[model samples]
Target: MLSYGKADVRNASHLALSNPLSKCAESTSSDLATSKLHTIIDALAFRARSIPDQTAFVHLVDGEVIEQAITYRELWSRSQSIAAYLKAFEPNGKRAVLLLDTGIEYVSWLFGLFHAGMTIIPAFPPIGSRGLSRLALICADAQPDIIVADARFSNARERLNDLLPSAMPQPYWVETTIPTGGPDCTGVGPARDDIALLQYTSGSTSTPKGVILTHANLVSNCENASLWMGDIRGRVGCTWLPPYHDMGLMGGILQPVYDGFSTLLINPGHFIQKPFRWLSAVSRYKVTVTIAPNFALDLCTDGISDAERSTLDLRHVRAIYCGAEPVRSRTIERFTDRFAAAGLDPATIGPCYGLAEATVLVAGKPVDKPFVSFHVDREMLSRGTIQVVDENAPGACPLVSSGRPAAGVEILIVDPLELQIVPEGRIGEIWVKGDNVGTGYWRNAVASSETFGGTLPEVDGQFLRTGDLGALLEGELIVTGRLKDLIIVSGRNLYPQDIELTVEETDSRIRPNGCVAVALDDGERERIAIVAEIKRSEKLDDVAQELLRRSLTAAIVAAYGVKPEHIHLATPGTIPRTTSGKVRRRAVRDALLAGNFAQYGGRTRAPVPADRSAS
Candidate 1:
C-alpha cells in the first residue's frame, strides 16, 4: 500500500485552499442571471440550457458499479415528460409525495413535481414494519394529493394501504414504471417564496415534523453552502447517504445541481453491508468531495482490510465531511491514522455541524488547515464552563470544533429557560437566524412558534431555536450534545454520547459505536444505565454478562465515580435507532419505563479496581 507523509497532508490542504470559493466568484453577467433565478426549477432549466452535456448524476449499483447515469439534458427531458403528464391532472398547488427509493427516477420526479408547481414531499420508501407505520403517519399528516411510487414496490404499497386502512381517502398514485412520452413543459414555475418542499424531521427526538421549505430558503441555503464548501466547481462528489434525509437531500442531490457539478449516489444499504464499496468508488471514480456521518468514518477504519487499503488512491480526495451524529475525536483520529498509508490526508477529515431546519449547513471547519480539537475538563464542561486541560490529565475530555458560522448565518447561544443570550464560551441552546431557516412546520403552528419563532431578550427578528447544546470558543462552534439527551446525575450533566463512546472503547466484545446511555431513576437520584450491543460473535452467557457489567461499571466509576444502575447487553441490531441511524435514547427510556427490557439478575459482585489509564 502507498503511504503519505506530512508533505501529503500539507499538499492536500494547499490544493483545497488554491481553489477557495471559485463557485461563488461567478462572472457578473452570470451572477445577475443567477440572481433572477429563484426556484430550483429555474436552476434546473439554467443547467440544462447552459451545460446540457454536463453529467448530472450517476447511481452506483450495489455501491460498486455505475448502473444509472444521466446528463443535465437527459434529466431535463425526462422530467419534462413527467411534468407534462402531471400537468394534465391540473395540479393546482397539490402536495405530492415521493415514495420511490434513491435512484435516477427519484431525481426525475423531484424536479418534475417542482416543474408542475406542486409542493414536494420527499419520503423514504416503506421498507420494514416501522417504515410502513412511519410512512402512514407522514401521509396522514400531509394528506398528499398525489403519490409517486415505484411500480416494483407493489407489495409494500399493499401493506401500506392495509396499515393506513381506507378510513382516509386514497391518494392519486403515479407509478414510475409507466412511460410519459409527452412534449416539453410550458407552464411557468413557482416563485421564490412559494412552498417548494416539505422536509420532514427524522423523528429522532419525537414525531417527525413537516418542515415547510420555500424555494427562496433552499436557494439561499445552497448559495451559503457554496460559500462554506468553497471551490466546489468541477469537484466530483459522492455519497451513500439516503436521499430523503436532510444531509443527503441538500448536500448530495441539490447542492450538485446548484453548483453545476456532477455527483455519484450510492445505495446506503450496500455501504453498510460493505463499507469498502464507498472508498472503492471514491478511488475508482476519483471522487474529490464526499459526505457521511461519523460512524461511516469508523466503519472504514475498522472494517476495511489491509488488502482493501492497498487498492485505494485518496490523494485526489480533498474533503470528507463527518457529521449527522456526535463527532468523536477518537473516531476521526483512528480513521486518519488508518488511511494515511493509502494517501489519505489527515487534514481532509472535516468535522461539521448542521440541522434540517437550518438547511443542512450551519458551520463547517475550513479545509485549508489541519483538524483541531480542545481538551477540556469533562466534569467542568458538564457544569457549563470551558476549562482547558492537558491531554494526559485526569477527567480530560477532547472536543472537536465544528468551525465558524457559514456565510449569512447568524448564531446565538441562548439560555433555553430564560430566553436570554448566554455569554460567549458557555453551553446553551443554538438559535439560528438566516434565510436558510424554513418558514415553519406544516399545519402545526404551535410547534412552529415554539421552535422557529425564537425571540431573544433584545433581538428584533425571529430565530429558529435549534434544540442542540453547544458553546462558542475562540469564534468556533463546538457542539456538545443534545439538550434532550443530557442525563443529569446528582446535579452533574452527563452527555449520553460521551458515555456511549467510553463504553464502546472499554472492550472489543462490545460493538463499536453501538452503545446507548440513559438516565435511570432510583427515586432519590438518577444514575447512569447503559444498553450495550455486544458483537454477534460474542454470545451472551451468565459469566459473560456479569464480567461485562463489572468491567463497564468499573471503567465508568473510575472515570466519573458513579456506579451504573444496570448494564443491559443486547444482541446486534436489537437497539432501536432513528431513521437517520442515530441512537434513540428517548425510545430506550420509553422501553425501560414500560418494562420491555431484559433483566440480568445475579448476586452483586464487588467492583474491581479500575485501570489507571482508562480513557
Candidate 2:
C-alpha cells in the first residue's frame, strides 16, 4: 500500500526542479544531425555473419519451447532465398503487405523484405475481423504490389478482394511457412526519401489513416532509440506487446534489432490472460532490456503475487520504457515499490514520450536519472502558463516531464491557432520537426496537409502539429493533456465520439443527442466510460439498461470491438447539458460519481393504467 500523502510530497518536490537528464539548451548543429538507412537489418546481417551460431529469437508455445538461432551465414543465406521467393510476384518487387502473425517467420520475412529491397506494411492478424477489413481497405487504397500472409489469414486476401474492386490481376501471397532462404533477387532500393513502412493507427475512425514512414525516418528513429536504450547488443530484450503497434513494432522489436540484439517475444493475449507470465518470462529469459506501456506495469503490480515475485528477478532490466499513453506518477511509484523486493530497480523505470507520427520516440531520458516533475495550477496550465509550485500547495497537480527531445529531434511548444511558440513554462501544442518524423499519412492529403504544413512563427520552420497539449519547463517537455476527444485506456487510444455514434445508432432509448462519452479518472486509474439518458421509469430503465448494454456491447465488439471500462444510465433530461444543448461529459461524470442522479416521478415513471372500460 502507498501513502499518497508522502508520495505526493516527494513527487511534488521532484517536479519543482529541472530534469537532470535533459539535454543542454544548445541544439545540435545541422551538420551533426545525421542518419543511415538499413542500419538495423545491416547490423543484424553483420552479427549473423560474424557469429553464425548465435541465438536470434526464442519463442515459447503451450508446453512447447522452440528457439531459432541463426549464424550470420545462415541468416544471409536464408534472406537471399526469402527475397528470391518474394520476387516471384511483382515485376519491380516494389512493396509487399506482410500479414504474417508474430513468429520466427514474421521476423525472417521482415528481414527478408529489407534484403528484397521491398517496403513492408505489417498488419496484426487478430486485430479483430473488422480491423483486418479496415487494414485491407487501406492496403487496397495504398495498392501494394503483393500481400504476404500466414495460412490462417488467407481469408483476408478474399476480404481484400471484396473491399478493393480493382486490386490487381492478382495479389501474391508469400507463405512464411516455407523456410526457403530469403530471396537473392537484387534490385536497388528506392531512395531513402521513398516510403519504407506504412503503419495505420488503431481504427479510430471509419477510414483509418496510414502513417507514411520513409526508410530514413524509421532508421533514424531506431538508431536514436538504441542510444536512449543504451548499447543492447548481446543482451536479450523481452517483449509481449503486439507486433503491429508502433510502440511494439518499432520501439519494442525494431530497436532491439537495430542494436543487433536477440529478442524473446510472447503473444499479448497469453500475457493478458496471465499478466504474471510477463515477470516469469523476464526471469526465465534474463531479459536485460524491455519496454511496455504504463498499464502493463500496473497489471503486474496489481496481480503478481509476493510468493511468485520472490522467485523472479528483474534486475537485469536496465531500463523499461513507460510510454504509449499518458505517464502517471502513481503508476510509476506503484510498480517500483511493488517489485523492489524482486530486484526491480526503481530508477530503471524511464518515463519517456512518443507518438505514431514521430515513428515512436520524440523524447526520452536515461533510466538511472531521477524522474523530474513540475507542479502548476491546472487552471493556469489550461491557460498555457506553467508555474511551478510546491507539492503541498493547494490546487497543485504535479506534471511529469517527458524528458528532452531525442538526440536529433526538435520539439516546439506553440499556440494552436497562431502557431506562435509559447514561452518557457507555458503549455501549448507539441510540434516536432526531425528526420524521424514521418513523410505523411497514406491517402490522407487533407489530414497530412493540416498536420504537417504549418510553420511555427517562433521556430521559423515546418513542424508536425501534435494535437497533444504540453509545455516546456526549463527545456524539458511536460505533456499535460490532449485537445482531442481521444480516450486512452490502458495505453491504447479510444475515440469517444466513435463509441457514442455506435451506441446511438442501435439503442432507441439512448437519446442520441443526450449522450456524453468521457473517460472516468477515479484518482488512481483511467478508463473509457459513457453516460446516456433514457426514459424515467423502473421498467423503462431496466429495459433500456439491458438492451443498451447488450446492443452497445455487441455493436462495439463487432465494430472497433474493444470493451469500454463501464457504462452509466441516466434519467431522460437529467444529464447535465450546455446552453447550446450539448451534453457536458465532465459534468455528467462529476454528477454520476457524486451519486447526484435524480429520482423519476414524472409520467414516464408512472405505471400504465390497467383498467378497461368501466366493468
Best by lDDT: 1
In Å, residue 269's CA in model 1 sits off its true spot by 0.8
Candidate 1 lDDT, 1-615, residue by residue in tens: 111111122233343453221232122223425346788777777788877877788776556643567778888777777777787678748898888777787888888788888898888778878888999888888888888886665567667777674778767788775455665568645778889889999888799889999999888888887777777544888888998888998999988887777788888899999999999878766788899899899889989999999988998888998889888899999998898888999888888888988878898888666667999998898798777899999899899988888898999998899878888778999999999999999999999999999986568799998899998888889898999888888788888888888889989888888789987564666766688877867666788788888999888888776777767777667678878998877787666655465443323223221221111
lDDT (CA) per prediction: 0.79, 0.64
After aligning candidate 2 to the native by TM-score, how far in Å is the CA of 233 from where it should be?
A: 6.4
Off by over 4 Å in 2: 1-39, 63-73, 91-93, 126-128, 166-170, 179-183, 188-191, 458-460, 486-615
In the range 37-69, model 2's lDDT, one tens digit per residue, is 354455555555544455455544421133333
Tell me how many residue pairs clash in candidate 1. Answer: 1
RMSD of each: 7.5, 13.9
Candidate that would win on TM-score: 1
Model 1 local distance difference test score: 0.79
Off by over 4 Å in 1: 1-35, 165-167, 522-524, 598-615
